[model samples]
Target: MSPLARKRLGRVALNAAGVAVFLFAVFPVYWMVATAFKPNDQIFTTSFIPFPDPPSMDHVSRVFTQGVAGNSIWRYLLNSTIVALSAVVIGAVFALLAATAVARFRFRFRTSFLILLLIVQMVPAEALLIPLFTMVKRLGLYDQLLGLIVINVGLTLPFSVWMLRTFVAAVPKELEEASWIDGAGRFTTFWRVLFPLVAPGLVATSIFSFITTWNEFVFALTLIGDQGKYTMPVALQFFVGQRSTDWGGIMAASTLMTIPVLIFFLLVQRRMVSGLVAGAVKG
Candidate 1:
């Protein structure tokens, strides 16, 4: 084969590999959605069907009507939303401030502080459950949504700070200097000049925090004592029983749980892409 032909063949192989990887990643999600709409009889049958022959809304309807664990399905969704949103908002603010400090200011123990943040991120959350639980209980935040929000913020904060510091540092110091020369106050410079550039990174971090908090299971399960206060992740467990699992209901609820994440990604995906690219170029 000529060199040009071999290069073309290699490109074709790469494209084929990319398509295969995409399909492998997407198949499970497609299956879940398909199964959610399948009738119980169809779902359990030996024959594999790519899509439901005649789709049914029975499972989805059951999830809404019958609810989960003595509370409406909406309640769990609301709890998850509240916790995720709260964590994202709180975590982002603190992360931004800390990032700003570390990125812009020189201080003693700065390296140590960054290292500590990394150490915290490296520590598995499961290992801290006992200490966190005791601390939450002592603070009288046990079994409350606030406790879960606080825990999520703490869990996500270190990574948020670490990720955001890079973005902050990537922002050209010349821009801030120019703003200062123009007599812009510190707050004005930050709000007007720095914020727009950092917004993408902030959005990316918020998405991460939101998704992490939304899908968080262990802390929600351990911290919350009230069944009614359970988030969607914990509530999904209601579909499982010792005798037989409600596969249909499980799939339906799982599908519902994924909608917010998809919506969030769609809303900010462009900014996220740009943010990542800009960070890479700047770094």
Candidate 2:
């Protein structure tokens, strides 16, 4: 084959591979959405039926109105929101301070501390569940959103700190030096000059913490046992019963649960590009 023809064929092959990977990644999400919208009878009737025939709102209405296995989904959603937001708030502050300290100072065990954070991230969360649950119970925090928040904040903090450290370290030291020359205090220099540069990183970290905590299930399930205290994921289990499963309601609930994360991503989408550029250029 001619070189030009081979190059064109290679381009087509690459495009096809890209499309295949995209579809593979997206298929599950599409199926979930499709299943949620499908009527009960239509679920297993045909794989090709991508949407509900009559396009009913019954499942959605049921999710809002009916208490699945005696659990209030809306209340659980509120619990999830409270836990996730609180975790993100507390995690971000701790991460910011820790990141700043690590980035600016040459302290003892600094390298070890960074390495420890990476190691912790490598450990599977499931392995720590039992121990964490026992600790939470001993502390009288079991079944409370406060306990969940505390655990999530701790879990997400290390990575957040590491990420922010990179972003902060990337900022020019000369900028801070110039600020000090102009008589800016340490706090002033950090807040005025460094904070703006790391703003993107902070936002990125917040999003990560929020999503991780929001979707977290194992910890939530083990820690919070009461139906009233359940987060969205735990509450979702109510849809499955020994006798039968409420496919429609499950889908509707799943769909509803996904909206907040989607909205959060959409809101931050504009900042994401700017944040990446800022962090990259400064670093």
Candidate 3:
């Protein structure tokens, strides 16, 4: 083939690969939504049906009306939201402070502290489950939403601190110094100058913490004994039975569970880009 033809062929190949990857990632979500609307007959059918024949709202209606485990589905959703939001807010505050400290202040064993954060992130969460559970129990935080928030904060804090540290370090210290010379106090400089520069990283960290806590199941299940206190993930288990699984109900619930995440992402996603632009102009 001529050189131009070869280049065209490679471009086509790259486009094909991109499409394939997109399909791979999105197909399950599509299937789940489709299945949620499918009639029981279509769902049970062995044939591949990409779309629901007649999109039925039976499963969704049933979930709303019947609920799960004798508790309203809204309760589970509320619990999840509460835990996730609380963790995000608390974690973001501490992570930004810690990141700022690590980047700006030189303390004894500061390097060691950063390393320890990385080490904590490296260890699997399951490995720390037992110890965390014990500590939560001793502190009388177990079975409460506060405990879940604290656990999630601890689990996600290391990553946030470690990630935000880079953002903090990337910011020029001269800005703060200039503010200080201009009669700005330490808090003023931090809030007015430093915080804006670091906002993108903070938003990113908050998104991570929210998604991690929102989807967490093992800790939610093990820590909370009351069915009424179940988060969305734990509540999802109610759709499964000893001999059969409620595929439709599960899909509907899952679809419902996915919306808040989409909304949250949509809400912050613009902030992520805008903050970067603002920081660039400010710098």
Q: Can you list the residue pairs that collide in candidate 3?
A: none
Give the alpha carbon lDDT tens digit for every residue of 158-259 in model 2: 878876787788898999999999999999998999999989878887997898899999999999878888889888878888898888788888988998
lDDT of each: 0.90, 0.86, 0.88
lDDT of 3 at 10: 100
lDDT of 1 by residue, 99-152 (tens): 999999999999999899879988999999999999999999998999999899
Q: Each candidate: how many clashes?
A: 0, 0, 0
- Model 3, 56-145: lDDT tens digits are 999888888888998878889989999999999999999999999999999999999978987888899998889999998999988899
Better candidate number, 2 or 3, judged by TM-score? 3
Q: How should the candidates be ordered by lDDT, best one leading?
A: 1, 3, 2
C-alpha root-mean-square deviation, candidate 1: 3.0
RMSD after CA superposition, every candidate: 3.0, 3.6, 4.4
Per-prediction TM-score, please?
A: 0.88, 0.87, 0.88
Error of 2 at 15 (Å): 2.9
Structural RMSD, model 3: 4.4
**Error of model 1, residue 273, in angstroms:** 9.9
lDDT of 1 at 217: 95
